[model samples]
Target: MPEPLDAALTKVRELLLDPNLTRAVAAGRRRGQRPSVVRAELRPVVLKAGRRLQISTSDGSRPYTRNVAPGTEAGAAVDALLAEPFGNWHVETADATLQLRVTKSGEAQLHRAAADRAGAEPSGHDRTKDYLLDPGDPIFAEIGGSAAKRRQVDAFLRALAATLPDELSGPLRVVDLGCGNAYLTFAAYRYLAQRGVDVELVGVDVREDQRRRNTELAERLGWADRVSFVAGTIADAVVEPAPDLVLALHACDTATDEALARAVRWRSRWVLAAPCCHHDIAAQLRTRPAPPPYDLLTRQGILRERFADVLTDALRAGLLRLHGYRTEVVEFVDSRHTPRNLLIRARRTDGTATGQQRAEYRDLVDQWQVRPRLARLLTEDAPGG
Candidate 1:
């Protein structure tokens, strides 16, 4: 498979074709929930309005697309949203919200708009000048983002930064397990710092070669002051000033479990793990009796692989709850881009784990007839009360 694009172009014509990006911007901002917005050059899409179809700018003047569902509240929301003057419309569904921004673009044209705004004093650029394209800045190109998409990612990262604790903030200590090439660690450090968040980061991997190259890159980024690397197996190494946030991106199977073990032992406030390769649990699942209605799912290899993912994350979530952490298993990004799509963001809950939590976990494992790699590892040698 081709290397996944860390970001995508902001050209409206090109982006409209990517189903995942469309869904994300739409789902992100809708009525009655956090809003999702997108910025793009104008491209009017025509929609059938009963007997006649009208093609118009997303002026909100034309009614919502026919795909929009019906209901009193939905109708009211749509009407209210349309009254606003926007080249793009914000659509809010029951579970998703997206924004569409449409504008015309060109370099000289943008500068003209910015100059126009500056003349007004205490002013910002005219709407036409707000765009993702800025030939002057190359970071946008290197990072795979248009200025527009970078804004979206920035918003998401800032939100994530807020959700994690302060310990993960000030001189924010971080450890990235399996930090091959260290691109993400680089992104995180830059993202946080740009937002005035101070961070000290460490990238861990078994490959001495990768560590050497990454350390060189760190120095070049001027992060040599706060960032460094330790060469060895993640399990074998230990970090001083225990990290406030621990990330193990695509750590294979039991390796993911090991990453989690390290975070939990340190009792780190935040744990982010995008687990990859369910080969271990899939092996155990081979012999298990299928739960009643799920028996049919196991018959299909594709479905079985899918089931392994859900079952594994579910068990992992339950186990986290049992160990006093609040967890969310959410779409880290679109599945179309990566098979390892689910991100487990766990925050430590101060209270002790309740007996009910333990009982529920046991019940879930019994029903799945499979044990999670993390559960098996952590439960062993757990202190007897």
Candidate 2:
């Protein structure tokens, strides 16, 4: 294609090879990689882990690369590549002898300024990304531990991006239900605001302590004007004028259901929840063991946990589907610090469901004697759902 910068690139290292370093390098070159800038004659494929690339340089020798080691660091490198979704790149001539790099002076200044402000002298703005990302919004970076993990995060982000209204014109109205400590809430606020999207966010949680701390955090981050905190049940939170987006991350037990119910009541267009605790089903299972079919499976402890998780989420998806929503269940994190590791992402859709879904949901609950938290949450108000 065309080399945009004067700096020549050596063989590119796959983030799959060393994600940390690759991410560092990418962060270093972040300014130059902006949409209006980044010019490169580097013919490369952004692969999953190790990048698979073929470039013919001026030497007339085809540049072929592979990161066969595929170790832990390699996986991280891949994640880095995934993290950087905006890298303006292209190839050189057909012969592809020379690789070109284009970086703008303007972009360079931003990185330097950030590094200087952060007091990270030698670390370079490149290496200081972790320091920077963690202080404010670290959602994308923290989602995955390796290349594979990042791929999952990428999918979730993609789903969210797609479901959003194409025209993000006015300020966003967001409600983060059960927003304990409000990590994700704060991250979302920072992200939307940085992207130049106006946002008004409210974090709702039952814990008074979390609300107090989060309020203090909003003030400390200077986001008090853009974000607020409410201490109470997510169901009781006053979501004035409704919300465009509702996020309930790792809300324990029926709290996720409560958040969804509120979102549906408000007719929220977008909803995301990482649910914890399937205790409702486990509790039901304790009362009634099971019939013959389920008896074979519920006999094992590990199977029971796995089954409980699947059953609980399946019911949730069904419930959402019944309410004209598209839903998906996926892993949130591999960390053991918390047991609520699955994310249930749902977006409002116009598609009508097939009849089997409702029947299947009923059958599963009946067979397992599991009364879902969702069923209880919506029972009083949701008709035919």
Candidate 3:
């Protein structure tokens, strides 16, 4: 109702129109108002014609999604949503994150942080952040295929930022289990280092050749001391002093379980994992009969495969919750770049799981008639197991 409130709404409109917008979330209904669609989200998508804004809303039961072309059409849609009784708004762009909260008196409080900043050359030229990585970056030149990889990195970093601790007093310790070529590994290190964070990063890969190559690359980049590599399996990787953050991108099948289990064992503060395939659950679904009424869910091979992916990640998040972690499953990238875009981001809550949580997890497994690899790993490693 005041300047802050009006200015905040104006900024929200500007964000909706900004081409660099990554994602925006509007949540929390104002007091005395009950909104059907409690949460609304906006993100960019690639279309055959051009880039469009994808709008998704949830009514606490199901989600409705649609896309609108960028420009006046998107602005109109955003105006309608902003006129709703939402009390909170969060926006992420290429350069920063902005949060606006409305108080009971209708006063808006706004906070802004430059989470992602562009780099500049000594010659007074700015290094363009096409995604998050500059196209002329040496890392891309070394790896090849800069455009797609940059988008993937940008998406992954967005998810990572959700779980990163706010109070970072000391150096951040990180481990990338099954890091393969370590594209995300290097990207994480570079991004954090740019933000003035002291990072000690380790990348673990099963292939000795990969470890050597990545280690060499780190040295060439003058990051040999901050970033290193080890040759080991995700479960067997020996990382001393543990890690504050764990990253496992596209670890195939149950290997994701190993990485997650290892992170729990280390009591890592944060974790971001993007799973590649769901063969373990898919294989089990093939042999087991689907639960009653839900049989149609698995009637087709393609549908069964897709359902297995959802079930696998849902179970994985449930297992993480059991181990004193608050977890969320989010889209790590636009589906156009890769279908394997779902990411499991978790933070250590250090709170015990309630009996109801355990029972619900068990019920889901029983109904599905399948055993999850993550469940076995967490159980076997628990105390008295």
Candidate 4:
């Protein structure tokens, strides 16, 4: 009923040896395995010495890569990986595609298909160098992270990179608010620095330990002169020379509001935030009745929480518009990696909100009778108030 494991392994070997093999990825770790490698990928590479097969493996957070001649120990290691009860194998060659899934009963199920006609080479970011955080970096190895964490960092960087304006002149000043652990802070510094952009980076958090540890990390990376950490609340953190870019990743609830308000106050050219926890609005919704014709919106606790998340972000985006900043709310990472993946990117623009935009924002707030923290923070001294 199923292909023999040896037969599947033989096919894998053939594919691995094929010069036309574009990419081969093995994922889903076997239970109770040593080294804890969760995923691996094989790709052909041409080195100065000669052609080699590059094997990249991720032990969850950290990624490592090595190359070896075909039919050597490295090749045997790749073959052994196929025999493991890894969940899935996806292989792509110039002419054919192979998909294999391992069943709980240790049987191999294989599927084959014609390779889709090649299109323009797919556009992609280099996972290692393009990101602020690289799994292959010494910092990641020191901190101990997985492939998934690396993906999250890459996703966030991709979004931020997309929002960056083309015009640039001088050193970029960046402030990371509520930068707990400062993983992304360090990453931002690395990304900008690698691009030959002069960067002045500061990470702000409430914890003194985090500040001290991040400061140490910066010193180790030889970035102490340019990148430093401070211990303070997002609202009170002091950044000198005013930041051109303000970043807040997963700042919880009203804290996110504080970060945005701080950015607006500084007139920062760019603001990127990934808000976490909609507790404040969710709490407010519990005490207030929903508007007519929309009572079903918050009928169930789960639905109420989800609605609060959307309402909170929508209001935040609207308020950004009201403040003359173009804004977008986008997914920061795959939902499987983290549910709190929404990123709000705002860029200062010459345009301001129209009368209708302001009226709609006001109406929504009035109808819901919920005062968003961001609105209150941004509009505390506005005309109506």
Candidate 5:
């Protein structure tokens, strides 16, 4: 049922000022016009002297933040957010979660549910701030991601949190394809386990040493029963009871193709991949002349390399859409954290390739005169392949 907008806003302000407030998030533009910040969030933080509410805003590419004292200051901040044309608002306290949505007709629809507990305090990029991944996890001492790696893991897990289903029928089986060092592998397991999720995870790496080291770490952490590592290639790794989610982070060059191909073949429900290099497509671009007048695009070594990265990922996304998956290419983290920051997040859907889609893909490949490894791996029997 819809609630009075003023009433909802009042309740939200109260929650924001409450000392128990865990988090408050506002997303999407309600007015259908782009806002200065794509997303904004507020959470309670404990300072050395006292408690305060921290507000963080992200403009899709970067984040800016500020801290306000509780009571009037926090309420004013909350009012400023409510005044914005954000489509959705969610607030959580120690006891309950409240959600508000603005309808097309300007009605306020609200929902409430019990919350389990206080949210985890993630390790913040700034020494004084909090982030999405807790910095003090025991695994960090062994796996080591507290510094530079923290941003990558936090960004990846934030996507996973949003992608995971609201409810689960049984244990979630996850496979990390080409999980070299397995930093993310351990982080995922620990995060889900802490949430009381019945999750079983497997990390596959071609190197036997990595597998052994990860296995030893898992055993030492008392997670060997639920988390395991395998010494095998992403293309040939045998994960019993095919995974519900597949993660391929930083698989270099065409190795990423191999991982995506394997995930599509398995019909995994979800896939999150962060490609490391576009060497295959870049090398092909160097060998062939750019299509017609666009020759200027590839005339320079640096420009050609950057263009190949864009073209390669675009083609990869188009291919995934043709393969019955809803695909989105997103920057999971800031480029400063890692140059290879593009993450391909896909969810299995009933989408079918239309004649127009197929034609466009074919036309693109013909114009470029370059065969992407992903296309060749996925559509070997197709005409171009």
Candidate 6:
């Protein structure tokens, strides 16, 4: 049993008006929602224009900010927001804190912080990321990238570094599949090198031109000994030593599946893929009728497209789990930078899929009648198939 949403939101309203409200965040999108806004934060700001509430939303790659007067439209917007089935809310005030979390089974839990506890302070970016490539570095300047591009690169490297296991010994071998410009490839090598982690990095792309450009850049950066580029498809890229980490950023359509399948075959310890495009599944959905009671999902082109994206990702996660990987689909960055910011991060786990997990995967594919590219790639002779 939990308090009603209206009641919880009333408390939110009260906290929002409090002068001491330090910060507030609402996140965890509802199922089938189209908005790339997976997370949003609210803070008070007083500009020369007027006093307003700064609402910022991130699709996962970049942040977009909008100011709203604390008036009728703001109240209506908050009301509409509360109507969304977002799974978590955190509101911090000078004297207290309000938190709400909804379980996967739809049970809501409320938590309150002690009155004496101070509200959480705002966090700032780490200016002293000595291990990371500086934005002002000649390499970025040579590439003629914007400040925002540098920020995205730094954020991505920080995330990748966080996922590295501390217990691992020896130099890290990394392969960047579909490494178009190899910005991230160079950044990864630089980040690891600064931390005294010996690294062997290879950037693979289908285009020989990109390979040549990246190789020349690596040499210019004085990393020719440890970093190189190869012209080949992600599915067939050859590296003498297998990679410990396989990265595929913004790999389009079935290319993402190919990268993941390669990681599985190579038994890489970590896999990170930012998928782009959902045309395959959407095309399949258009060719056949959706199952009964779900016809509304495919009744409109936009809804059908959106539904396919969700289903495709869901099936990919399930298939990854089946392959003995712990998978999480999370916002890779804010949507402002790129809408295709969803990241599927899979780390090899100790256990294989349970029978229930396999059954669920089968059920979804059977119901949708859409064979995901990853499923076809990873499950040709799957256990219990």
What lDDT does each candidate get?
A: 0.55, 0.56, 0.80, 0.77, 0.78, 0.74
In terms of lDDT, the poorest run of 10 residues in model 3 is: 120-129
Pairing residues by index, what is the TM-score of model 1? 0.60
- Candidate 2, residue 279: lDDT: 78
Q: Is candidate 1 or candidate 5 better by lDDT?
A: 5
| Deviating ranges (above 4 Å) for candidate 6 | 1-132, 380-385
Give the Å error, residue 94, model 2. 33
Across residues 1-385, which tens digit of lDDT does each residue of candidate 3 receive?
3446877899878977798887777765555564556567788888898899999875532367899987788988898898987766778777777777777687787878974544533221233443554443335534554668777877877677667855567889999999999988987876676455678899999999999999877654446667899998888867887999999999999999989988998899899999989999999999988989999999999999999999999999999999999999988889887898899999999999999999999999999989999888877845310
Model 5: per-residue Cα lDDT over 282-384, one tens digit each: 9998887888989888899999999999999999988888999899999988988667889999999968899999899889999999889998888654221
My TM-score estimates for the predictions, one after another, are 0.60, 0.59, 0.66, 0.66, 0.66, 0.64
For model 4, residues 1-385, the per-residue Cα lDDT tens digits are: 5776678868977887787776777754322332235456787788997878888875433457898786666568776776555555777777787877655465678888986664524421132345454443444533446787778768877887788855467878889999998887877776565455667888999999999998876654445667888899898766676899999999988999999988888888999999999998899999989999989989999999999999999999999999989999999999998899899999999597899999999999999999998877876763210
Relative to the unseen true structure, what is the C-alpha lDDT of residue 278 in candidate 4, on a scale of 0 to 100? 90
C-alpha lDDT of residue 7 in model 1: 18
Best by TM-score: 4
Better of 1 and 4 by TM-score: 4
Q: Which scores higher on TM-score, 5 or 6?
A: 5
List the pairs of residues colliding in candidate 5.
122-131
lDDT of 6 by residue, 124-228 (tens): 112223436655343453355687788678768867866787555786888999999988887787666545576788899999999999887665444566788
Tell me, by lDDT, which candidate is best: 3
Ranking by lDDT: 3, 5, 4, 6, 2, 1
TM match of model 2 to true structure? 0.59
